[model samples]
Target: MQTYPTGVAAKATGTPLTTLQRYLQRSHITLQPCDVPSRGCGENRGYSQRRIIQIALTTELARLGIGPSRAAKAAFEFSDKGNTGRPVGELYPLGQTLLVGLPDGKSVVINIPPDKSISDVLSNDSAAFICDCGYVVAKVLSNLSKS
Candidate 1:
C-alpha cells in the first residue's frame, strides 16, 4: 500500500489543510497520532494514506460543486456499483427549458438563455442531482487513479 503524510497529500492534491479536515470529518475516515511532531506545533496528529486519498477525492468533487453530504453518498454508491454497465440518463425540467443527459455525460439543454446560470432554473432537488453527478464523476476519477 502507498503511504503519504498529510502535508504531502495536501501539496500533491492542491487541497488546503482546512478543507482536507472538513472532508475527513465528513467522510469519517480514521486517523492516528504522528510519530514525529509537525512544524510549529507540539501535537502529533496525522491522517492515514487512505484517508488522504479519500479527502483529496472529496475535495476535488466539492470543487466541481458537489457538497460534502452528496459527495459521501455518491462515493459510497459508486464503490458498491462499479462502472461496468451502461450509463443512466436523467432529465431536469428547469422552468420552460429541459436539460437531459446521462449521469456521466455532458448535459444538453434547450431554450435557455445564455446569460442565466443553471441554478436559476433548477429546484432544490435538481441542484442536488447535479451535485450527485459531480460526486459520481469524482469517484470515477479516484478509481482510475488507483489503477
Candidate 2:
C-alpha cells in the first residue's frame, strides 16, 4: 500500500496541516502506520490510506461542532471498529442527518426535527443532537469484505 506524507495526506483528507498536527500530538490513537512526528522532531511522518480516512472522519466531526479532542477520539474509535485498510468512498460526507439500520433489521433517520433549524438547535440549550447511523458500520464491513 502506498503511504502519503503529511502534506499529501492533509490534502487528501481535506484537513488543515496545523489541525492534523494537533490531532497527531494530542490524540494517543494509533493510526495504522506513519503519523505525524512530534513538533521539532526530525522523524519523517507518513500516512497510510486508513489514516487519511480517519483524518477525513475527524474533519467531519469538527464540522459538526465537535471539539478537536473529541473529534479525534470519535474518528479513531470509528477507525478501530472497522479495522480495514481500505479508503472510504469520497462521495460520502457527514450530512445533516443519517439513516441508520439497527441490529433488529430496523432503520431510522436521525436529524433535527422539521420545525427546527440548525441555528435553533444550537441556540436552544434544551435541544440535543441525535445520530443513529449504524449503516455506517455496515458500509465499512461491506468495503472490508471486498478486500
Candidate 3:
C-alpha cells in the first residue's frame, strides 16, 4: 500500500490542495498515519488508498451542497466505517449508484439492492445524491496511476 502526500492525494482524489488542507485543518480529514510530532510531523502527513477514497467521497458530498465539515465527516465515516454495512471503499472501481439520502442536511447512505432502480431507491427520500463510486474511483485511480 503506497502512501501519498497531501498534494498527490489531492490530485489523486480530484480535490484542490487548498480545499483538502482546509478539510484537514477543520479535522474533517484525519491523516491515517497521524501527523503528530512524535512521528515526524511532515513524514506522517500521508494519505493511503483508503484515504483517497474518503477524499473522493467528500468531493461527491460537496456536489450535493454539503458543507466542508459535514461532507468531510460523512465521507470519512462512509469510507472508514461504511454506511451500508460495508465501507464505501469496498465498492471502489465498481459501477454502483449509491443512493445517499440528503435530508435536513444529514447524509445517510441507503442500501440499494443490485436489482433495484434509482426510482426504487428514491421512493421515499426527499432528496438524494447519487454517488457514482465507479466514476469517482476511476478518476482517483487514474490520477494515482499517473504518479
Best by TM-score: 3
Ranking by TM-score: 3, 2, 1
Worst 10 residues of 1 by lDDT: 86-95
lDDT of 1 by residue, 1-147 (tens): 344556666665567888766766765433434223246666545544434444554555567676666554443332222222312222123222332232553333322335675655453323233333333334534643654
Give TM per candidate: 0.39, 0.50, 0.76
* Shift in Å, residue 14, candidate 3: 2.2
- In order, how many clashes per candidate? 0, 0, 0
Write out the backbone clash pairs for model 1.
none
The runs of at least 3 residues in candidate 1 whose Cα sits more than 4 Å from the true structure, single-residue gaps closed, are 27-51, 76-147
RMSD of 3: 3.2
For model 2, the stretches where C-alpha displacement exceeds 4 angstroms are 33-43, 83-147
lDDT of 2 by residue, 47-104 (tens): 6655666676667657767666655555554443432232232222343443222343
Worst 10 residues of 3 by lDDT: 92-101
Instruction: Write the residue-wise lDDT of candidate 3 on 1-147 in tens digits.
Output: 567777788878878888888887888878765332225754646677878888888877797787767777666655666543555456622235363647665665455667767677678677645565666767888999999
* Model 2 residue 39 CA deviation in Å: 12
